[model samples]
Target: MFRRTFWFTSGVAAGVWATTKVNRKLKQLTPESLAAAAANKAVEAGHRLKDRAVGFALDVRANMAQREAELEDALGLHADPELPPARRHAAIENRNKPKSYVIDRTTHTHNRNEDH
Candidate 1:
C-alpha cells in the first residue's frame, strides 16, 4: 500500500512538471515572443554585417596602399608625405587641364570630300 501511494504521488508530480514545461514552451511560441526573437536575430545579423563591412574596408585600404607602394617602387618614384598647399593646388590644376591636339584641317577636308 505504501509503494502504491508513493508511485501515484511520483506520477502526479511528473505530470505537473511536464505540463508546466509545455505551457512555458507554448507561451514562448506565442506571436509576440516569436516576433521579439526574430527582431533580436535581425539585430544580431545587422551587427555582424556591419563588422564584416568594416573589416572588408580595412582590408581593401591595406591592399590599395600595398599596390600603390609597389607601383611607386617599380616606377622609381618616391612618395612625398607632405607638400605645400600651393604646390598641391597647382598640381591638381595641371592634372585637370584639357589636352590640346592639332589636327590637319586640309587632310580632314579631303577625307570628308572623298567619303561623300
Candidate 2:
C-alpha cells in the first residue's frame, strides 16, 4: 500500500514539472519573443559588417601606400636626404624659371635672343 502511494505522488510531481517546462517554452516561442530575437541577430550582423568595412578600408590604404613607394623606386625619384640644401634650392629655382622667346612672324621661326 505504501509503495502504491509513493509511485502515484512521484508521477504527479513529474507531470507538473513537465507541464511547467512546456509552458515556458511555448511563451518564449510567441511572436513578440521571436521578433526580439530576430532584431538582436540583425544588430549583431550590422556590427560585423561595419567591422569588415573598416578592415577593408585599412587594407586598401596600406596597398596604395605600398604601390606609391614602388612607383617612386621604379622612377628613381626618391629624394636623397643627404643632398645639400643650396643645391636643392637651385634645382627648384631652375625648374620654375620661365624662358623668353622671340618669334619672327614673317619667317615663321622661333628664336631665343636676349635683345628680343
Candidate 3:
C-alpha cells in the first residue's frame, strides 16, 4: 500500500512539473515573445557586425601607416612633418575663408557656334 502511494505521489509531481514546463514553453513560443526574441537576436548580430567593421577599419589604418613608413624609407625621403609651402598656404587661406552655403541653380546658355 505504501509503495502504491509513493508511486502515485511521484506520478502527480511529474505531471505537475511537465505541465508547468509546457506552459512556460508555450508562453515563450507566443507571437509577442517570439518577436521580442528575434529583435534581441538582431540587435546582438548588429552589435557583432559593428564590432567586426570597427576592427577591420583599425587594421586597415595600422597597415596604411606601416606601408607609408616602408614607402618613405624606400624613397629615402626625410622632410619636415609640416606640409609643403604651396599646400600650407592654400590650407591657411581655405581655413581663413568664410564658408558659403548658397547653391547656384542658374543655367547658362552656351553659344552653339563658338568653335568648329
Candidate 4:
C-alpha cells in the first residue's frame, strides 16, 4: 500500500509541474501576437462602423421614400419609377439650402456610445 501511494503521489507531482511549465510558456505573448490582437480589434471596429453607417443610410432611404410618395400624391403626378426616392429628397434639400456655409471645426464632444 505504501509503495502504491508513493508512485501515485509522484505521478501527481510530475503532472502538476508539467502543466505549470506549459502554462508559463503559453502566458508569454510575443510582439507578433500583440500586433495581431490590435489588428483584429481595428478590423472589428471598422466592421461595426460600416454596419452602423449602412443602417443609418437605410433609415434615411425609408423616410425619403415615404416623403416622396406623399409629394407625388399631392402633385397628382406619377412618381418616376426610375428615380430613387432618397435622391429626390436630397435634391430638394440641396436646392433649398444656402449656397455657402462655414463649418465650425471646434473641440468635439462625444456621447456615451462614442469612443473617446
lDDT of 1 by residue, 54-84 (tens): 9999999999989988998999888566954
Candidate 1 residues lying further than 4 Å off, grouped into runs, are 80-116
What value does the lDDT take at residue 7 in candidate 1?
Answer: 100
Task: List lDDT for all candidates, in order.
Answer: 0.86, 0.87, 0.86, 0.82
- Cα displacement (Å) at residue 109, model 1: 55
Minimal lDDT window, size 10, model 3:
85-94
Instruction: Give me the candidate number with maximum TM-score.
Output: 3
Better structure of 3 and 4 per lDDT: 3
| Candidate 1 overall lDDT versus native | 0.86
Native-referenced Cα lDDT, model 4: 0.82
Write candidate 2's Cα lDDT for 56-97 as tens digits. Answer: 999999999799789989999886789853332334445554
lDDT of 2: 0.87
Write one digit per residue (lDDT tens) for candidate 3, span 65-91: 799789989999766778663332334
Off by over 4 Å in 3: 79-116
Candidate with better TM-score, 1 vs 2: 1
Per-residue lDDT tens digits for candidate 4, residues 41-114, read 99999999999999999999999979978998898978577886543233344545564553444744446798
Candidate 1 — which pairs collide? none
